[model samples]
Target: MPTLILIAGPNGAGKTTFASEILTTDLKGVRFINADEIARGLSPFDPASVAFKAGRILLRETAELIEAGTSFALESTISGRGHASTLRKAKAAGYRIVIHFLWLSSPQESIARVRSRVKKGGHFVPSEDIRRRYPRLLHNLVHHYLPLADLWFFWDAQGSPPVGLANSMTHAISDVDRFIHDR
Candidate 1:
């Protein structure tokens, strides 16, 4: 069966970096549907300017991949309800849904990382947007994603080399709730 992997977290929580590493390793050749990469490829101008257009194209491409029964991975903030339905469709189409979540301690960290990435010439997300998305990401993760997923992996993204928190396959952790809620 094909797998639909969601590398999700708050904005700037290192989803793209983790996705790159995993793609090079075990998930070689899986089509990665990243909006930022698409944005960069879309224009010679600033990627941030065409971000919304890239997002729309990304959504279309993702749907096409799903409809074609292709195994793929995508990065998301998981801050809204849209992905819940996407996961449902993928599941019904015989895809094994997998979630790999990267967690930061707070929105401040998200803001900091985004600022740093912007300085390094990455696309910029407004600080207000980061703040708004942080709690929503965790809330949606708990309520919308975990139950639907076939497997999951959670990571602590604070360190240079991220540490594993837990995964549904073998390393489930009890404090996952406390860890998320307390932050």
Candidate 2:
């Protein structure tokens, strides 16, 4: 079956690292979709300037893949309603949806990691953006994305190295909710 695996969480939550691990396994045939990668390709010197264009291109590519029943994976923060409609379309097109969500205790963790990345010359996301998206992403993860997912994995990204809480939603839902509600 065609699949759409979403590596999602707030920015700097190790979504890309997890996605890279997925790629190294049996998903070699799946098309990889990272907006930052697309933006960089559009303008290496100033990727942020063309971010919107990259998003448009990603939307187009995803639509085409859905129409063709192709398997793919993408990165998202799940902060807004941006991906809800797309997942609906993918479901309609018979794509198996999987979400691997990386969780941090707070926005402060996200800010700290992004700052570390900036020191290493990585792309920068403003701390304000991370702050606003943090709670919003968790909210959407619980109310929107979780229901659509055929399979869901939650990873606690609070440690120096993140750890998986559970591999299946059925096994993890209560714990996941508790973790979220505790904050």
Q: Identify the leading candidate in terms of TM-score.
A: 2
Per-residue accuracy of model 1 over 16-131 as CA lDDT, tens digit each: 99999999999999999988889899885788888899989988998898999999999999898787888999999999999998999999999999999989977789999989
lDDT of each: 0.88, 0.87
| Candidate 1 segments whose C-alpha is farther than 4 A from its true place | 170-175
How far out, in Å, is residue 114 in model 2? 0.3
Candidate 2: stretches off by over 4 Å: 172-174
Best by lDDT: 1
Which residue pairs in candidate 2 have backbone atoms (N, alpha carbon, C) closer than 3 angstroms, thus clashing?
none
For each candidate in turn, give its C-alpha RMSD to the true structure in angstroms: 1.7, 1.5
Name the 10 consecutive residues with the lowest summed lDDT in model 2: 166-175
Cα lDDT tens digits, model 2, 37-102, are 999999999999999999999999999999999999999998987787889999998989998889
Worst 10 residues of 1 by lDDT: 170-179
